[model samples]
Target: MNRSNASRGGVAVLVLAGGEGRRLGGGKPLRRVGKRTLLDHAIERGQQWSDTVAVAAKSADQVGNCDLPVLIDQPGIGGPLAGLASARLLDCPLVLTIPCDMPFLPDDLMARLTAVLGNEGASLASSGGRIHPVCGLWRRESLMQLPAYFATGRRSIMGFAEVIGYATVGWDDHWFVNVNTPIDLAQAERRID
Candidate 1:
């Protein structure tokens, strides 16, 4: 089936690339892993499940040039929460958020989350005793609570996810050791090959 048809049931992928990446130098998305940039790899992973893919960025320059639409972070909010809020307005019924740097996320990740999503606020991926809210499949409408969530002086992905109610499916921690520093990037390079 064409990639478009795979997600015609109303699912879209939103690659969250808005972080400043101060720890790994700037331009985290542009960081190279193997023969591809982290953004490119994340986009490819999105394409594996949906044709409708977008990048949620802090600014246009953050993502540079890309064919997909770039949803800038909401006016007064930042971080992954802002990315989710920007995507909340999407026409699709569901949106899967994936960090640009988790290159080893399981191929069945969305499927796993969707299977347990039910009527909850969102379904997230967990590993090593912690939930990775950035790697979640959210009901688009559930994100409408963003404004309310932000009012409490909170701006964390996990905090908002809990406020809205969420379920998690655990995975091996190895698949989620995200790149955050020069040393981590070097380790990712070795793993990629």
Candidate 2:
């Protein structure tokens, strides 16, 4: 892991806590993983990648006391796309989108993703042949294409990646394991041990 690149570029990280977390009984980001909430872990880890870490939550009220700036989803609650756009609008060179529910994300994620910077719009981290779209890094410039993509009403991140052609960066599957259900949280708890 390249600790040296911990703070790279004028990058900003957007922890997408705007999801309803319907699969995990709601407030998943605030769920405890060990001694810390998932949102706490997300923000703590996010601080390593960028000095300007912000959160995109469903409502500002959901993350009121967070150390970072919290932006509410625009009137529509447009999912990760809106979060990504909000982060980009900060005008940073790169903005990494991480799902708040993914507490065990690799610490070196931003370094690994930005390692292939000059590739297409962005390169998603892939493990075991599955693309972790929300666990990926994107350039602020990529937002230029998002508006047009949103116009099509297809909000899938993979769909947008396909339209823009992204490079693939490989990482260990454990590094990208997302905790969505109680079962997943239990499994991740064991993994951490």
Q: Per-candidate TM vs. native? A: 0.95, 0.88
Instruction: Write candidate 2's Cα lDDT for 1-193 as tens digits.
Output: 3555544547888898888777788887788788788888889888877777889987876665787788776665267776766765665877888888877788778877888767578778888988887877787787678778878878787887787777778887777778788888888677656
* Strongest candidate by lDDT: 1
Query: In candidate 1, which residue pairs get closer than 3 Å at backbone N, Cα or C atoms, i.e. clash?
Result: none
lDDT of 1 by residue, 1-114 (tens): 776585545888999999999999988999999999899999999988887899999999988888899999888887788889988767888999999989888998988999
lDDT of each: 0.90, 0.78
List where candidate 1 sits over 4 angstroms from the true fold. Answer: 1-8
Best prediction by TM-score? 1
How much is the lDDT of residue 26 in candidate 2? 81
Q: How accurate is candidate 1 locally (lDDT)?
A: 0.90
